[model samples]
Target: MQIPEFSKEQSALLARFLAEQKDALSLAQTHGYLFAVICAPEPLDVHQWLEQVVPGCDGQMDEQVLFAFMALYQQISEHVFETGYSLPVSLQFNSAQQPYLDMQECQHWSQGFMLGAQGYIAKLLAAPQLASELKEALETAQQSLCFFILDSADIASIANQHGLTEGLLCQQQYEVMNEFAAGFAELIEAVAVNSQLYNDEGWG
Candidate 1:
């Protein structure tokens, strides 16, 4: 299906709406979180997940705005399922923003993803064979969130300790985050397949 591209204007609008709802996650984070949830082994109900992330979404958002968000969700889910990759281009920090703000937003996106994944961690953990890989990916993503918590002094100190420029450190973190996303996508596919096999065997 040809899903409409999630445009900047829509992003801004959603951000504003989320802000009005006193949501902790920005539009970017929310999108990232939802994308992760959609890629889960046994995905959450789309409408239920939407309501959780976007409070009052069904009642408050106009038809057009609601449709746009749903379309974006569907598109991301389909992309991940068909391609075995998350929509990194769409999920990444917006470069047009100031560097500091971009970094902060990236942290928020990671936090949101972690929060989303926590809901399914129990199920994933129950499968001991997959637990270690999923846990490692989650830990790497969690580490990425630490960058936003450091003061300038702390950041500089850490950079110096690593014998790397601050810019290089940030770039390294970005690469790690990308790897985390890819790892997560693989986990999701594995879980989905396992669930299918279990069902096929009438193991329910």
Candidate 2:
């Protein structure tokens, strides 16, 4: 089925609306959250995830605004289903005139993704019947994404686990962005292939 794409103007409007919302996820964060929702082993309810994306949206959202947000959600979900992990990460030029991802934007995006993924990932990994190799793959993928989202202490821990010194990870932020995108693709592929196995009673 061909879905209408969320145009740049609509995205701008959504960003403006979100800015007016108290504690609402930023546009980048919303995109990240939607991406995670699509990759989840089981789907999350639209209303529930909408609430997460825009706190108190159900109680007070304007109808047009709500419709636009829902369209945004549907577009991202469809993109993931069709294209796997095409991360909507923004890039900027460094001092040497080299292009690299905007780390701050990546951080916000990853933060949103982590929030959406936490419960689903925990449940997926905790399944007693899950295979060891797949489990390891998921853990690694999670860690790669976590590097951008975690607190200083947790980020340090991951860096240390990989035999890197403190703060060294930030030195290669662009490389980590590539790793994050690769990991997300891996996760989407893994979950897509094994989706039926995860569609248990409560999740359905």
Candidate 1, residues 113-154: lDDT per residue as tens digits?
766776555555465555465556545554663354456677
Clashes of each: 0, 0
What ranges in model 1 sit over 4 Å off? 1-3, 56-60, 83-101, 126-158, 191-204
Clashing residue pairs in candidate 1, if any? none
- RMSD (Cα, Å) for all candidates, in order, is 4.8, 3.9
Instruction: Name the lDDT value of residue 204 in candidate 2.
Output: 29
Scored by TM-score, the top model is 2
The numbered model that scores best in lDDT is 2
